[model samples]
Target: MSLKIALFGITRDIVGTSVIELPAPAPATVGELLAEMRRQYPALGELRSCAVAVNNEYANADQPLHTVDEIALIPPVAGG
Candidate 1:
């Protein structure tokens, strides 16, 4: 299966786009997905302080993920 991810802030720069598709199989979790993404895009190293959301709600690292789930990365904010 394929999962669509919406990248934001530093994540967008790391991924070079606002969206990305991830491979599926062997189960997936918010943490696992983020880890995999970090592995795929080392540039995301800046995402150490990032949080994740599933279906518009803050998700825990251990939260299970489905192949068709909507995932988004909410990185640290910096503004006045």
Candidate 2:
């Protein structure tokens, strides 16, 4: 499974990269993906809030995933 995810802001800091591949035998849904991410990157779990997008649209936890889908992780942003 080759699901690539783009990361922004603090998510990048937590993951130490702007993009990452979902581990082999990819998650089937957004929630599963998040759980797996927190497993691999515990720092990601510390964030109070984060947003996930699939194919450029805001996604829900139950949203299905596919190897072809475009994914992104958005961390909460503070407006100055």
Candidate 3:
């Protein structure tokens, strides 16, 4: 299955794109996707923190991923 991930903030900068296409097996987990992201874009691993969202809702590490899901990578944010 091919998942399209929307990138935000520093994630977009690190990935150099607004969207990314990740190929994974059926029913991939959030953890698995994250591991693959770190492998494909090591810079993403440098962030202080990152969050994954599916269908506009925050997802847990064990959450299952679907091919039609709308995934997003949200990097850490700092404000004074």
Candidate 4:
């Protein structure tokens, strides 16, 4: 299944875009998707410590993601 992914925080810079498309296995979970993302974008290594959100709501790594779901990568905030 294909899903739309949104990048926030530092993830956007790493990906060089605010959005991307990804194909995930059936019955995909946030964790599974993340793993695939890491495989696809080795530069996204920092994703290991990032948070994930589905359709604007915080999601756990184990949460099952439906096809076409909007996923966002949210890294921890850092500022002065």
Candidate 5:
């Protein structure tokens, strides 16, 4: 399955793009996708924290992913 991921903040910087296409296996989970992403872009793992959103809602590690789902990578944010 092919998943489209929208990148934000430091994630975009690390990936060097606003979006990325990842080839994932069927029945993949958010956690699995994250691990694959970390494998491809080790910099992503350096962040203090990150979140994955599917269809505009935060996804859990066990959340199942679909190819047609709207996915986004939200990096940690800091404000003064």
Candidate 6:
């Protein structure tokens, strides 16, 4: 049971990939998952305005997660 997280914007650059998959027995909550990722990729911890989306909807820190859940990292955007 693993969690695959889609990466977008700066997150993709920071993580150096479009997707990141956690090893088996992934974290149970959004916050925990993010925390685990941050610990692995210290650069990700530098992001101050990132959002987590689950199954196409914005997710909170305590949102429950499953191995099949669709997760995405949404970073701030800017336009000229």
Record all residue pairs in model 4 with backbone atoms less than 3 Å apart, i.e. clashing: none
- Tens digits of per-residue lDDT, candidate 6, 1-80, equal 78999998899998899998888888889999888878887888788777789999999999998887889988876768
* lDDT of candidate 2 over 1-80, digit per residue (tens): 76899999899988999999877788889998888888998988889887789998989999999988999987787889
Sliding window of 10 residues with minimal summed lDDT for model 4: 20-29
Candidate 5 at 75: error in angstroms? 0.6
The TM-score measured for candidate 4 stands at 0.78
Q: Rate the local accuracy (lDDT) of all candidates.
A: 0.80, 0.87, 0.87, 0.79, 0.88, 0.88
- Write down the worst ten-residue block by lDDT for model 6: 42-51
Better of 4 and 6 by lDDT: 6
Report the C-alpha lDDT of model 5 over 3-79, residue by residue, as the tens digit. Answer: 89999889999999999987645338999888888888999899999889999999999999988899999888676
- Worst window of 10 by summed lDDT in candidate 1: 20-29
Better of 1 and 4 by lDDT: 1
Error of 1 at 49 (Å): 0.4
Residues 22-78, model 1: lDDT tens digits: 755533888888788778877666654878899999999999887667789888878
Model 3 misplacement above 4 A: 24-27, 78-80
RMSD of 6: 1.5
Q: Any runs in candidate 2 off by more than 4 Å, and if so which?
A: none
